[model samples]
Target chain A: MTIEALGQVNVTESPTAGSRSVDCFEKLEQIGEGTYGQVYMAKEIETGEVVALKKIRMDNEREGFPITAIREIKILKKLHHENVIKLKEIVTSDGPEKDEQGRPGKSSIHGNKYKGGIYMVFEYMDHDLTGLADRPGMRFTVPQIKCYMRQLLTGLHYCHVNQVLHRDIKGSNLLIDNEGNVKLADFGLARSFSNDQNANLTNRVITLWYRPPELLLGTTKYGPAVDMWSVGCIFAELLQGKPIFPGKDEPEQLNKIYELCGAPDEVNWPGVSKIPYYNKFKPTRQMKRRLREVFRHFDRHALELLEKMLTLDPAQRITAKDALDAEYFWTDPLPCDPKSLPKYESSHEFQTKKKRQQRQNEEMAKRQKMQHPRLPPIQQPGQHAQMRSGPNQTIHSQPQVAAGPTHHYGKPRGRGAPYGSNNMSGGGPRGSGSSGGGYGVGAPNYPQQGGPYGGSTAGRGSNMMGGNRNQQQYGWQQ
Target chain B: MAANFWTSSHYKHLLDQEDVDMVNPLDKEKGITLEDFKLIKMHMANYILKLAQQVKVRQRVVATAVTYMRRVYTKKSMTEYDPRLVAPTCLYLASKAEESTVQARLLVFYIKKLYADDKYRYEIKDILEMEMKVLEALNYYLVVYHPYRSLSPLLQDAGLNDLNMTQLTWGLVNDTYKMDLILVHPPHLIALACIYIASVLREKDTTAWFEELRVDMNVVKNISMEILDFYESNRMFTEERINAALQKLTLRP
Candidate 1:
């Protein structure tokens, strides 16, 4: 019997029948590839508003819908904050229509072509933090870094208070609009966790470089402290102009973290040896934490906060709320207004990576042309030329001007392909080549811009769960 | 939102008693009365429970799946969205949304094995297709705050640490799902109502504890009355009555 035979009657007039059709928005250039599918920059036909339409990939979904997409939509719907990316209404495309490129749609389920496509509409942002930082000759001033950090912490604090753990916190996921307003995006890895310590959350979350030491040692039970570790790494990256720990794999990742943060032991972390992989990956020798020594040039308050955030013990790691209250934020060169930060052309992680790949290809072609004088220069894809001439190209022509000796461009590090890449393995996404701190050198410092900052609006009087409750009962409580 | 019921979609979607009881015009045109609609939903909720048992998901998954099925019928008609197909599809979607994913192939395997009837037997494609429709009908708000999350905490606070009272109260919360109390009341309030019922049955005093919660007792009484009414009427829900209600929907030609 068919679905139609089983009472699949047309109820299009019903208020909940379907969302506004995807026809309302005209598809623009693809901005990024999300965990499921391509994220496109589209313009609304009615309002002329630019939006990021994240296509929910339906092909090969053995289960009905992707759990990651469901979690993202659910979390985004509940979250309403200035620093978090807003998910506009979800829209659907009609059956089997050819795309803008005149290619047949691949909307299918279990090898059977499905009728429509689902697109989660989100407010469009111009640049992600990685793309902005990766720009040649681009450097964030002290105040600018503070501004982004404050926003990041504010956003993260809101998520934590809401009981949502953004398991994936990295440079590419932090989207920055033209107004220099940073928003925490990509909630595919985010899940609502409870205070119950018995709940077994997967340890395989967060990108490799920014992954916390506890997670590297295979601790299944964790909390908001995990995200704080990544935030600390990001804070140090902004100050030093490179990633603090760029390890290649899990074992080396633990090694890099131990080398910087010192190896975890019962004395420092308390019950550290009880962690699942603690014995397997335990350090052979005790390593001294030289955070202050290595970051001697950093502001004293910044160093203090970093120490708390990068604490070997998950229990001791500073929370987003406490981090916001740190003396570093209150010190001189306070975070300026997000609007006052310099507005550059649109630069997403996807686009910049493509641009970097194009440049590498061009350099390779140039060297090959010198070797074989008679051969014509390699013709790159037409799309690459279009991408190269995009608005961000003007900034690309500048020479690699370093801000200091510490600002050398390290090679791009490897990281997990965005969350939800593996459905069955239940592990985190597999590692892919991510451009981390390689292009952070040669950033031109900006003047301390904008007026005295109005302090963060987050964590103030929002009636979040356990907002006023005692935290001593939770395992993550310090 | 999962922790706080106030800002959750579950809170936002809570309907009035009349709104929850209102039968869809399309279903009405198909000769399905208000009683028939309720019976049909109740029957499908049971169907979802059995399917969930076969799939071996948690009680939370079953609760979420049943809640999804009920929510679908609120905006959709049983005539257009068949309760037979919608019931299983909701379980499938809820399993994934709740992070206890059961494959579509497994669901299809169980459906064919459980139901010999052609109407109840759906292939994997049909369930997958209905999943999209269910997602659309839900407006993609899959996060459901169940009374289960609040029950234990309320029980502990009320000092009803006894095993029998806890189990009885938990069963009452489960029974609340068979009705539309989930659609009308906040989850915590529902938990409170269940505790109120259990205290009376076990002959315990929780009035002081309930008072300290600072919630309006009137709403709790209303929800408690609804639960009692469901128990009173469900005794008369015979197999023939369920079949009669199911027969009201116009079958495919």
Candidate 2:
């Protein structure tokens, strides 16, 4: 029956009882800014508990609620584990407080009546894995890396068992409290996957360096194996103190992966060639598996487990549960208890250091740009040499050029190219095709002649390139 | 925890019947009997289900919406918030939570078209305004585990995988949502109870399969009785009876 008529159902305005209002919380300071919004350190006046208040950016969000916020909230609500970051509660405040003290502020753009500013309250963490790792002269002990990995795997295992795929598992996303406990955070890209619901997930997830081969080849129907690949990358990065595959672009990313692990054939990954983007690019040459040689210091057991986790075929990759049960975790150099790890009196020390380094790099780039207004900012020494050897030849030979007389000498360090000589004259496709195949395929092959612009490489989805390897957002209460 | 019902928020936060009843101790003051309250809730569930179906959302969305409405009343009395407003709000939020994600404007359109009357018309703003209250009352615990997730597997394991048997068992599980069984029992046990009830209705002997499963049959029996009791008691209640009770309940507010 069509129960159609007209009667105004007057909903009684209940007195606000349990809304943790702005008056209840005293804002402390702005800690960090995430992709969605800025996070602030706040203290609950009643309980006096310090929390990271992540303001959900609703300014231009024409869509009712940001999908990432909704996904994170729904996932976090169901998850209750020690290693998983807790979402204490969602609280609403009067839109846009003027000061950090959160005093009775002026009317915001949404006006005084607008109470739609949603803030997610999270337990404050001190150090993120990225900040800790990026700390100058801060080298992680084998046991310390082990402890972090163990916690990461344990938290990841819990998420997987609950059918959630973290999708993003970089160092910065892993938060460490003062107790040295590491908890997985930033589930903005995460979602629950089920076999019955074969949803085609977006491939543009997980920062490029940590992205899996299956994802690089555009496999949309991936599972937890995608996350395992990232864990392997993090494990390797922790050990080596540098990203194993630091590709400049998508093709270069694939090339770097193939250079170290050897190119995947049909036998290795049954449908390797059938992936949507598979035929578009091919690793220049066959290379021997050299993870063992590259990580020469790692124990055999660790290498064995790493190999399994970094398997070219996602179908054959080790799961978080299997990786945890590996001999490496159980063997010599037992994982240090989280509490035993050394603590930094100032947790923000690393954050400040990272910011300073980034600032210096920016200043250096700006100074160099001013020196040669016509020249593109020189990224590599080799690029500078390429510029000098051009028509401006010999006429404007500057002091910097004289200091590095053999600037061409820098070509020997062409990354991922075992045989660097192939990038030069007379170095045919054969010349560099086997130094795990040289930069000739990626760089010089493009006839722009002056070498590909440095900015293009740096700007090519670097967030996707995510060499932010250092500036990972960490919300530390201290 | 979403996968493991024993450790899920559903188990930890869901209240028992007594506590749920305590939330609205003023029901008698509003001149509605406990039985009349049950009928009103049933009608509310039907209303949510109808709205959800019109939007072409999955069954899980409808179940979550109904559960949200029930949870809202477990803390606040019906007099505090009208069910007519809360029902649509729950459905709108559930659609987003379940990832079907219907537009608020579309929901308002369908809700007004279906439920609007001279005595009870709503605007899009009303639905949006009520949405926040529903979220607050739910305490933002949006994830809900349903028997259907576990029921399909149990049905297959019991060798009752035929379309007819599957549909019948699935229908039984949906009906169980009407009671507090979902809140009190693990989803697997609820699935088994529904399967048991479905088997009896079909006159199919699944005793051998049920024995294979090492579950507490006592719990299953209690669950079955709860569903049976609901059916027996509500058999005599009609739309007119529920409407009369709802008129009194809504009159005071």
Candidate 3:
């Protein structure tokens, strides 16, 4: 969709009854909950312009903004790509986000007047990529897939060149506007790459299902190529109507990949044996199956490109730029124009209900645990502290608290930022050859030909993958 | 920070007249130039240090307070907000942003006990209110990249690190910040010459050390000149100038 179509979401002027009348966005029902806050649809009080208001809930003023929220805000504030979401204004949220002065948060960056509930005013988006793909009447032709592939790549390439990696590159993370434009949305995992030559410090959390093999195998220090691999998975899913690799876990996931691409012998992918978990998994000889076997309905060219993208070695995987450049995108029939792509604003009641239920469930669970059963005793603050690796790769393994999925914020942070240099296993993609032989975080170099517990076969695939360091993304958010 | 003229907030607000300049000291009836405030700001860096240091806050927080003091001056003349009120307010906001919370009572107690000044009467609570205003004025772009982070390395790269060079370099950084060296010269140059001067003062005589180095000699010269002029103008070894600026500034109650 053209960037101009962002306004389609606010076609009807409805402001929530609670909104100040001066704002005049006739409130519609709630849209999706924002990544870290509440969201509602409203029309411009003056020009009748419609927009989405996201009220950010930063629990503690002393602790400051959530890092994920900060990451999203800082990136969104500066990014102006056609395929990116735009922040119109940052109003402090009204309901519960007021500060000691009782001022609604005008903006997260700005204090006081915009305090209480920090509101992020965004240009309206009609639907998300998941919804567009799931539209009951929608059917994607090969050409259309190519078109999306191109747009997705264009956006990803833009992100990469700007040193920002949209690590969570999945269908749901891509928002479709009223026109057919698909803009990249969530940036919680995005980070600026160093201006220096190192590229391995960035790739930690692309979603599983769409995650690259290097990530699945455990190469934390990988680069933009991991994102490219996801684009490949998403591209295939766009054509297949389901996840290309729906592995129950990382091992199964790798088996699914090997079934199509065949076992790694270091010929196709050079650094197989050197990976940290290389000795763990034994890739069984299941007579490699073809992509056609897995996705028999896809066109030959689509299968071919999928094969290139789904390559185990990220270094050899087809790039978003290259995929956009492929014959599959350009030949036989051209993809439909972005504007002509189908548009349907499905009722968001289900998503809204799910979010509300999740929040309720979390709160209830918290209360119940507190009131009844012997709760996990609240340990002192340092109980959860894991030793982090220091500057010299001297393993500290600082237990990192799991990053939030619950928008529960902590104290506004102060002086000490966690040291950027801390890395458990060189912080590279776990098993991909970059594993820390420096610290022996990997399994022994000798490949184990059997299961982790005795000879209970799942054969080679089970050994090397998920044997240890099960910290990979596995794309298991679901 | 590097000379990010195109990108720094300083460049964005330098000549613009959109903001409320609380310290309209330029005497609008007499009509003054932004250049005048800019220079005075350079001078005020010394003043802020004396005050901030008196309260025992981190130099980082002090620098932020000083930068806000400078930023506020860009739009408003110095005469608008009493610099005394503005200074403490900037310090308060800087403390919050820097994650160093000083209790208002303790803050007021220190201020009142330190100088015993009857003018600019303020309790800790009033300082907190002014902090919000300063935060609003600066727009919370608080990821300040100071020259200090870049200076030490610059001094070392100049082949200046010798016995006790690190200590002298730090002292130079601490003392240089008392003036507008930050406003005019980049950080590394100041770090280098301070090391040079320390070498000279110690009779280590490393004059030849600079001859072979390649850099903007003017920026280096500019920084040292600032330090020298500041030292000559103020008795930094004592708190005389701070006491003077405080008394002459006619602070608000």
Candidate 4:
């Protein structure tokens, strides 16, 4: 819709004098939830244009509006590119007196009733990278992967050039519309940086799986190389059909990086030992670099670019601009046009995970009937599995699954079964509890434990991952 | 856009002098003249600075907060937005947007501490509520380009990076917030105007430097004149006059 139409909608539907009310649009469904609040798919009442309405969570905020929301809105306003999510406008609603659960919100700190709600309106997109990649029997052609990677690099290049560090690049933050265009989303952790590199930024950012080695090593002084490391991780995930590194916590996460990218020493990364966490989490065993060996099947040029992106040294990490000029994008079977890729029904990580859970429950029910012919069908699917497996056993089974790299692509080996079985006994509660802090915090109401790939599989699709990591420490806890 | 001045929201939404100077109909109906409106905004800007000092935020955050307040007044009335509430709310929102992040409770504490009058004191709810209105009035275009970002580079380019001259030029850019120069002019032009003023004051020979830069000298001269006019007019703006102008505002219940 045009800007003039938006203005008219504001004037006609505004109940108050100052700003456009949320009455201008109709909320369709709760598509995703983030660290701040719920994200809804809404349609503008006047133009019938679909948009994403991200509620700015304010009910429990003693600090007024959330700082993350403010940063997201401010950064999104400054960014305008075909490859970046568009923040259309901000609309207000009167008296979010009732919280999302339809209960009266906790009394405001000042003992006054909750007054207003803010929703950041953004252009809608169909799929996120994690959701698309997790689709059963879905495999991206080489050209298609190139297309998404190129768009991601271009958008990232724009952000870096604009002096803004996205700080939270992951598969799910890459939103793809029906026409196959990928735009960067979720700038809540984003901040503008200067070329001087003197400022001390928070080292706790990016998802655990995608966080660069420097950030994991507790380096506060960083630049665009941090994002480039994430882009490298994403490129490898796209080619390998799964996450390259899925660590459960900080020490394990750093260990996983050492296993794959090799250990960072003074020779490869000068000043590596000077980082705050170097002595604490230092690897005991020397590990060899295995990017080429692990991803040998990948195209040679793609491997070359990944190697540069996954370099142990942050100083040697390839930039988005330089990565775009990499030969992988220019060689045979080049990156296809975004419009040429095929489209599918709207698939968000939340919806797909729900569908997978439901399907798994049905399959478990069928197995229960076949195994116990005389017993009545268990009413609570989550409880029956727990009753059989026992909680401790179920919990033990998960770490093994998480530790190994089980390639689930061509082999249809009981996808989601291990995770579905742990639903009540182990996975469900742990998943919900982990959402409280740290990098890769799952979205509210979604489980963080995924099928045999740690939390990086089905549950990693929401843009809410990689939330406020301030509560998480980088070094070994004493 | 944060890096590029020409393509920023600040550039796209640069208001004409007439647009920036127009008094809101609501304020005009409340018997607030054009001069009264400008005086109230100037007073609120100072109020924001004082509050920001109490909150211990950077001057950049204070400048951004003042810019937000000014942008709100251009599209809204002080009567509807409540200058007492909007001023602190702008600082609150700008602190978060600029990544400094002062707590709302801290702001409420200082507001109650700074102002004893019932009309000036506001609760957390009032400031939080006014923050939403200000964000809406701004259309969520929160990124602001300031002359401060351009001042140092321009000073270096003009070979005028001496301590006294640099501080004076920086102070000049800070004072430009008291006028409508931010809304009516690009930041670099404003920085150039500050440099021009500082060069004249410090007796620095930068005429050759400015001419070589190949910019519209007339616009720079006009901005310089406007800054001079603001200083001349506000020289006698004491506490009593600020109170009289603010008291004239018909605030919302």
Clashing residue pairs in candidate 4 (N, C-alpha, C atoms within 3 angstroms)? none
After superposition, candidate 1 runs with Cα above 4 Å error:
A1-14, A97-101, A106-116, A357-478, B1-12, B251-253
Better of 1 and 4 by DockQ: 4
Model 3, B172-201: lDDT tens digits are 777765554443444446666676667666
Give the alpha carbon lDDT tens digit for every residue of B149-223 in model 1. 778878887789679988998999998889987777777789899999989988898888888988999999989
Candidate 1 clashes between residue pairs 3 or more apart in a chain or in different chains: A138-A443, A139-A443, A401-A442
Q: What tens digits encode model 4's per-residue C-alpha lDDT throughout A98-142?
A: 677889755555543324567888899998776676565567899
Can you tell me the CAPRI class of model 3? Answer: incorrect
The positional error of residue B169 in candidate 3, measured at the CA in angstroms, is 11
- Looking at chain B only, the TM-scores across the models are 0.94, 0.90, 0.70, 0.94
Give per-residue CA lDDT, model 3, range A199-299, as digits (tens). Answer: 45423355445667777676656667878888877877676454545443467667666655666667778988787665576664544545555555577
TM-score of chain B of 2: 0.90
Question: After superposing candidate 3, which stretches have Cα over 4 Å from the reference?
Answer: A1-27, A60-62, A94-115, A195-204, A247-268, A271-301, A346-478, B1-136, B140-240, B243-252
Tell me the TM-score of model 1.
Answer: 0.82
lDDT of 4 at A206: 70
List, residue by residue over B114-219, the lDDT tens digit for candidate 2. Answer: 8656434665666666776777777766777778887887888888889999998888888877776665566678888889998999898998988888889998
Docking class of 1: acceptable
Sort by lDDT, top down from the best: 4, 1, 2, 3
